[model samples]
Target chain A: MSGIQKNIIKTLLLIALFMLSENMNAQTCCAAGAPIGSYLEIQTGDKRLFSFQFRYEYNNVNRLVENENRIENDPRTRYGQSFLWKLDFSLNKKLAFSAIVPFVHQSRNTISEQQSSFGIGDFSFITQYTHFKGRFRSLNISAGIKFPTGKTNHRADSQILLSPDMQSGTGSFDFIFRSSASKTFSSLPFLTSYASALFRLNGMNNDFGSTSTFVGRQFAFGDEVNSQIGARYLLTLKSGFLTPDIGLKIRWANHNLEQQQAAPNSGGYWLSLPLGVSFAPNEKKSIAFTAELPLYQKLSGLQITTAFRLGFQINYTFQKNKTDDILN
Target chain B: MKNLLFLTILLLFGCNKDDNQAQTDWLIPFDEVLDGGPGKDGIPSVDAPQFDNVSDISFLNDNDLVIGMFHNGVSKAYPHQILDWHEIVNDDLSDISYALTYCPLTGTGIAWDRVIDGSKTSFGVSGKLYNTNLMPYDRATDSYWSQIRLDCVNGTQINKVINTYPIIETTWSTWKAAYPNSEVMNLTTGSNRNYGSYPYGDYRTNHSNIIFPVSNTDDRLPAKERALIVMGDQTKKVYSIELFAEDRAIEDTIDGTTIIVIGSKSKNFIVAYEKGNLTEVVAVTDQLPTIATDTNGNRINLDGTIESGPLQDVQLTTFNSFIGYFFALGAFYEVEIYE
Candidate 1:
């Protein structure tokens, strides 16, 4: 491959790696509104000045587990789908801003009953600062605020306020912190490795489940930490580059507090493997598909865990300067 | 961009409300019945439970609580460790079939006859709760019954009362000693569960660990305090276990009906019987099958069977009663606490 072809291949691999790592943070269960992990914007390389991306995520939680043991006979299942739109604008080589808007649809099913909710979910605004940029490596840190744009008071058909887990929004303003880094090997310029970590400080919803007879109570989702490490390789094709990636993701959450007491079946640890493939038609656009499978899960109490997760993403970028290379 | 905006608007407004259209009529307030996370049969019921003789069982700790029942000269014990996970156990003894229903959230256990409308049917957890108490539904009629209220709260059999069998809730050591030949529900329940573990952490003992709000709050005692509550016609009274710390029986009246409550904090049990003719009943200690006695030397066994005296072989009728957490009893009824 020529030098320009190699550069395009590296950039494509990095984009695929970042996309795979960013999408690995979808919450396992009982998360209010859109998953906080979906707020992490993809790290579009310095060549792109602005980018718009849309992702569709489907998560199925049907595995009932107690600690580390799986209860095979539970019929309770929950399915969540989120449509996320993200916009990223780079002001300079070292600074960028991102905004994410999500629409969420959630449904829980049992043998006798079914409950579902759908609406606009929480929104996140983030500012990222590039800490270091080298020939083969880059580091970026970001901080953001999550707005309580979703509705927490969505009621069931019986006119009862749905539980926090079933609601479209948390009704609380939360804070998000994230950092990501990527590196390419000197010998293998077509392969890129990346890692990202995120921490979410959850806020409380004071008006949860308010009724005529009883006042609203306080509910807070547990704080969470999600981190992932992955590697992606690019293959040059006749029309585009095909990038395949794999990663290990770890998610840890503290027990949720309802009325200031630890809620049972609320928090746990999960380790999963995310596999994905991306097709970049050119430097300005790409499409990717990913699937996450749980390798190990240890929840606090008896809980329904995620069986698998599937996600599809499309990205379109506006470059600061146009290149006339065949690969572009 | 137009299609994206249209799709966004459609998803934002088209399917926002989550409605369960099947629930039409409810005897209680519909909004008060909260889904307890798990769905129907999510917390599986032990349909055909295996039992081990008291001497053959080895999994129970001395202080582990068990619900003891006796019928046709046969005794059986259901440990709290097992009940915390399964919540219901349907068992059959000869012609008698009953479901041992337990709610860890409310700390209450009551045995109800599986026969509803002259038909035999088992009960399953509805995965719904009122005042944080278990709401069980009968499989025959698919009707939901409130365990604390002992009445069908919803479905086809709404407002129907369920017949309850008296069960003795006591420590495992006390139960084994009282009925050495009793059969205890074993761990081979066919469900893959950690039977030795308590599913709800610190919920049983934490005074402020109530996950759901109660309609009525009685601040007279701590929320999680276990007490025996006797239900009468429009009247209910609670006798705390602390009142029987010294192993005594007290005669009390509820709506003009006389009753005798016998208990001991050390033994971790409280039992009550209708005071028909026997008088001056007093609690006893370390006597197997003999928990109380009257002035006429009538030996009252744990199951209320009179072993001797003028009422020999006659069983004392028990009042409608069960042990429950203080908060649950207060939330469901206007209960008067006996000092």
Candidate 2:
């Protein structure tokens, strides 16, 4: 196949991979960062592109258990919502850079106490590099830094320190590492598969000066590892192509530590199933939607579980000039 | 992978203020106490308590608990519904300022006189717990006083014990019957808090375990069993309410001081008064009775006054006391039980 045909096929495979893999961040208390869909693929050819994305996520916490015992219902329940903006820029085909900025709102209500917080959440910057290329497969690796830019010093009733989960930010810097691979089936022309793995290392927040907890003691969120695999089938249409994708994502995390000791009820594991559809009218634009259902989840302690989640995105691809190689 | 390793090493070594130990001169060692989540005044102590006539109270159930206080002919009841949320109420009755402190965890309540250093002040919840007891802080010095200990454990005024007034812990129905014309705390606390629900779910009923750590434990009784406790300068005594109800009345001596514990199971009320070699004390009536006959065949009113006898002018001192959980009495005081 020609280079142009190979590039088109690669792009199609990526479109399918994103639909199945892009879902939520781990739904842990006080966790930050964007959903998986926000991750951009590394371009290996000498084609430059830029895109922007907006996303919103929400969770309602109604159940909590401690040490395997379910906590009884309280007059208070927590609701967490986040808005994120992601920017992706392909510096060159071989390298890419992406940045995400988020705003978070959290609210909790109890008998005499009703509190809410809204502010910018943590920000992340990532760089992706194409490491290898083969006859029908490509590999990319990525590294990123998450900055503690969100608001952390929020109080309820002007004096009470809200729990870390209620704060918009974790007040800590984190490091991220990820790798992904995609392959096109030679026998099945319209089919492709992709897989990816990621790890995040959380740093200690020095400003954890809440009179509660350990006074002046620092806290670090537990490290996290997430992996997913998915496949997509392409169906030809009169105007564009319709792609249906399915994937499963699994995440494992350690308990958040305080003053070098593991904080109780702070960590767990989860598995989720993502189903999605993408419709592209032409090579220049496409729209996608995904609905994630939790298949199996067993948290470390009692926690608010996700009933379901939904996400949508619109993409418009633009080239600086009509590439002579693409039109030829 | 190499870049990931390098960044990890940099972050591990790039320590910030978290690397240094914080400078805190905690009067009470850090490990002995636990943060109750809310900061100072987080639970919000009532500085101005409002009351409505018994006829106006619509929220309390007959079985709900209340703290009844009486002074200089004025009587009022503070419902646990309000205390369950605020934990402390700073108010004045008969011109005497007091901090009515209640700890939900230990089911203990006490009225502390707020006169410190000759000036009156208010108290607030410190959002700190010691042995599952409430720790109140005075606004005058920000000193945290252990609710059961009744002494400042941290901050200025350390080691100072405030004077304690007397209070009675009884069911709302019992209190209303005793003082039919008394006023009850109104739920309109101005903070827009729900007055109907308990914030901690099943906590009052689940005595199997405590949410926070306590320093001591005694298996003499269940953690939640109610006990009438009396604390003297150097002596402490406990009478289990279950046994008190079974016996109705008991005369016991502790540390060479003899006292009489009287119980009315139907009214769910208990009180202790000093006894001096009295041969017999019998009630003339039942169910909220007011007349009793002492060993000398003298008629006595509920207030321990001689209505008829040679000792007509003599009066028995009723020690200032409150009824709380058996676990709290055992946890905080060196107790001599009157079985």
Candidate 3:
């Protein structure tokens, strides 16, 4: 056997290993801050490299569902849009740090009432480390903390405080853990397969609806697990590389707890398929567009679930040249 | 530099200010009114409800609770399975229009006349709660009415009291056996909802589960235990269904007025009426519209109607009474338990 064939075998083995380790947990049913996984895709390079990315996301939730069945003709609908800015700095070949800031706007509409809220969302800071690096595959692990920076006490036009799901932030400090792996085969040099899993351990917000009293005011978003697997193929162009990717994502969340009891219609499992295309004009800049469609959902109780999601991202990298490194 | 400026501008645009808040002059304490998660009409009300004969209905379990109403020689049953999803049902029968309102959190059900000041209008769930009970709103005047308070607490019709009708809430099997020819509200409520499922999980049986804060808490009985409460001038008395282990009746004087309470624990029903001429009342069985009889040969039904004897077809004036969760009754009124 040649070295190329050996590399292909190694890549296939890595893919199989990660696929078997995928964790299947549940997800929350309402709008939240953008998942940390969306901003964890950092490119491994030399030290002193810095990158910035901005993303816009739009989600529409209108389908009223009970368990796995869709209840048709529901007039209630919710729309969420978010703008996120992310910054990344590489300390070495194996270590990196990232920070993200988000702004979110949400609206819910029925035949008789319309409510909209907008504000700054929660902020997150993550530290990622490259655990394994080989010619055929690489593995990255990340851990982060989310701050309760968003406004949770926003009231509606009627002066009634909006529900937790409608607020821009969760009002709770949360912990996020993720592991991602990517592989490239020698026979298919332009194709790459990747898999990632993320788990968010949520904290409790003692001042969920009212800041005045704590008797029955505690609210905690359910912990969530999101996993995805996919492959991307790159097409080389004269000025850039155009890459198209598709993936199957499974998300599961436990029911939210209100006053130490599980809240109804709050959490469930969701399976979605995401497709995206990215254009890297050069190594320093890239733009990507993605669309996610929910294929199946089994919510804990009755809830309005996501119909579809659209996202656009722009990335810019600042490279540290030899002269800059010498100056430092 | 330009990119950062543009992003800063975008983030500034995301911060919104609400300057068009609706001015509310609430008759009740405004801070006590809490949002029930779903917005107004989020839990849609049944406007043009569909019905099926009791024999044709199959979605309800034998032990499932129902709200039964009788008027103009016709009987109807509204299952809690349906009411658990749609808390209000607006219906008309033989020129009588009323709304059946049930609050899942508080476990209280009442029937209110749809006519307000001689104008007919339907009611919708306001998605607001007082003492964790439902607050319904009239479609005509957009006024919020407390289900347990039986009065408008907000909007144009503040402080207006609604007239209520008498209803007997019992198990589906018991109601079906007594009123087999009754019409039941079916699942075809036009709005798609899961009628087979109880929306609140374990809330009916969990003694310690109270989702929202109550103004008053009573540990005399479990919070979710159902009891019949009769309201008088500045007085409220509670009669636990468990007190009637067998078919029995109790004559008690409350607020200087004599009242008769008839109930059966096995049948899961309790009804009360002002004692005017009722004498020698005793429990009877297997007679439709005749759960009790008197020595004067008068057969009394669940609706306090006299079916025979000297007062045939005459209706007994009922005291303001209804079945509610013990915690809810305690929250609204300082209730005295009838031993």
Candidate 4:
């Protein structure tokens, strides 16, 4: 117990030191290093503009059980880090093109289980076309194709949590498409809301079954895609340096097979309240960060959770004058 | 302009500044809400939590499924159908004692040992359970019950705690009643408007004057010969020493403790003097080496202070909408434990 306490103190000290250093270094987003947000987007704020973004994110998840049970570990923790780069260019005023590629490095292993596990996750590619562009907002429909970049077969020494299905990659092609648009508020304080609906057409993969004990691993299912609706309120503070954003998102997807077998289709709905702030250093350079909390997910045998997202944005100003003209 | 940027930076990094007062609401405590307990309905739920898939492996022989670890080996097949939905249904059968675990969130299924019969074993999920992963632990408690910072426990506000209960039922009304004084920070996340909406069991309103762990109380006396003491509002015990002795009170013993009866109906509870300390409570399984961990997986706090702030509130209310069902179903991954 004392050791635990000491470790806690050490962790706090480390955090304090990190914070202290962070203050001394003002990391304003630049083209040099991109951390999971807007850095690489080209001509993002204008019509007929080119854009790209590179993102890097780290996720830490742990599931612990109380009561020592005096038994070996029954908990699992996973740290997943990802690198994503995206490119989007408006082919013309009415048509647009976009692509996203992701690279991931993760080890799904457990110390208590005395088992070591590693794998890569599935990778995806997306392309889209703008069907319409309104005076205040524009609409684009995109088509996405995903490749199975993950390992379907993974074995370990002892027991662990990294399952084949849970691998960082899925070795198969999943076709998807989406339509997205964003409109800034006409009100005094800057407020903009965006909405997108994405669809997934399931692909065939032979890696799951024969290696798994799950039912769906035997046969491929039909199409499955997630439709997400989100809206954000960004209040451009009088100073314009800090803009706080409060957003809400709801997602619906089809992922359960047994229930689907029962109802030909059984899906789920997730409600999340995203709260964060956006920082604009100059008129053309800005960043938005948000935290996503799971409000409610009606499911069984699952622990309630609170998940969050921290995003940053650095828009590239190419042909600044033309971009400004487009915005006007 | 740069000066303004400095001020915004200061506001963003601040932590734990305005938190001082603690809740004193007598009606219901905040812990009852932030800390979850067993739910009302144990078996099935109205939401009909989706069960992804099921596979019957009863045909596998012991050699195919069982594996040797510390002192004994485990043959991992049973009640797979029941586990398909509940994920964590515990039972002691075939002389095999284990707790079933499943994460509907990640759709991962795995089993844990309650009392290791022979050897200590640390097994991971098969290639199937995707969302199913490892847990965090500390030496003080068995790694069995601890977790990392973001780990999810069975029934706790922080989403991380000891995993014991399989299902956790949360409701906004009950939480509000539990902490009426606390503000409703997020009307959407949860509201303080409703209370007592727990579906499984109500908060324990009636506690014995002398409950478990607490030593001095009238209820501890033998029922047969014990006295009934009631207090108005005086804070002090009005009738601390009331005696109504009966024949059985002195002569009989229930479950080893001497019983004392009082009142005509014998309806009054019993009391007994400490006849020697109660039997030693069984310690946590001591075989496995303990790993240091905190409730949230950081090292335990030395001063026993709360590492994270008080547990936050979880919204128990569920909402649905159109087009929400087109997604959320399908195979995410597979987990195979037994052969």
- The i-RMS of every model, in angstroms, reads 6.6, 11.2, 10.1, 21.7
Docking class of 2: incorrect
Residue B295 local lDDT, model 1: 95
Let me know the DockQ for model 1.
Answer: 0.31
Off by over 4 Å in 1: A1-31, A36-39, A42-49, A153-162, A318-328, B17-24
* lDDT (Cα, tens digit) per residue for candidate 1, span B1-339: 444445445555543443433335888876677766666787788999999999999999999999988888888899999999889999987668999999999999999999988899999998888888999999988888899999998888998999988899999989988899989999998777777888889998899888877778887999999999999997899999889889889999988889999898998889889988897998888786688999999999878899899999998888889999999999999899998
Evaluation by DockQ, superior candidate among 2 and 4: 2
Q: What are the runs in model 4 whose C-alpha is more than 4 Å off? A: A1-49, A58-79, A105-111, A114-121, A131-135, A150-162, A209-243, A256-267, A282-285, A300-306, A311-321, A324-328, B1-339
lDDT of 1 by residue, A38-94 (tens): 447545454557776777788888888888888877767788877777888877667
lDDT of each: 0.81, 0.66, 0.80, 0.31
Docking class of 4: incorrect
Per-residue lDDT of candidate 2, residues B1-339 (tens digit): 233234323322321112113325444544445445544565678777899998888899998889987777678899998998789999999888898999987888899999998999899887767776898888887777888887887777888877888777778877776678888988766444556766555556555545554556676887777788887768788877776444265776656778777766555667777776355776554534244566677665444545567667466677756787777778777787776
**Model 4, range A1-328, lDDT digits (tens) per residue?**
3463344345434533443443234111001011121222223334456543434454442322111111122233444444454555765555545555443433334333322222223445555565555545656676766676544433322122123323334445767777677676566334556566666665555534231232323213344444444554444456556656555656554533221121111234556675666665445444555455656553222321224444433333222333321210
Per-prediction DockQ comes to: 0.31, 0.07, 0.22, 0.02
Of the candidates numbered 1 and 2, which has the greater TM-score value? 1
Give candidate 1's whole-model lDDT. 0.81
Better of 1 and 4 by DockQ: 1
Q: State in Å the error of residue B195, model 2.
A: 2.0
Model 1 scores a TM of 0.90
> After superposition, which runs of candidate 2 have C-alpha atoms over 4 Å from their true positions?
A1-328, B1-27, B276-279, B282-285, B289-293, B297-316
What is the full ranking by lDDT, best candidate first? 1, 3, 2, 4
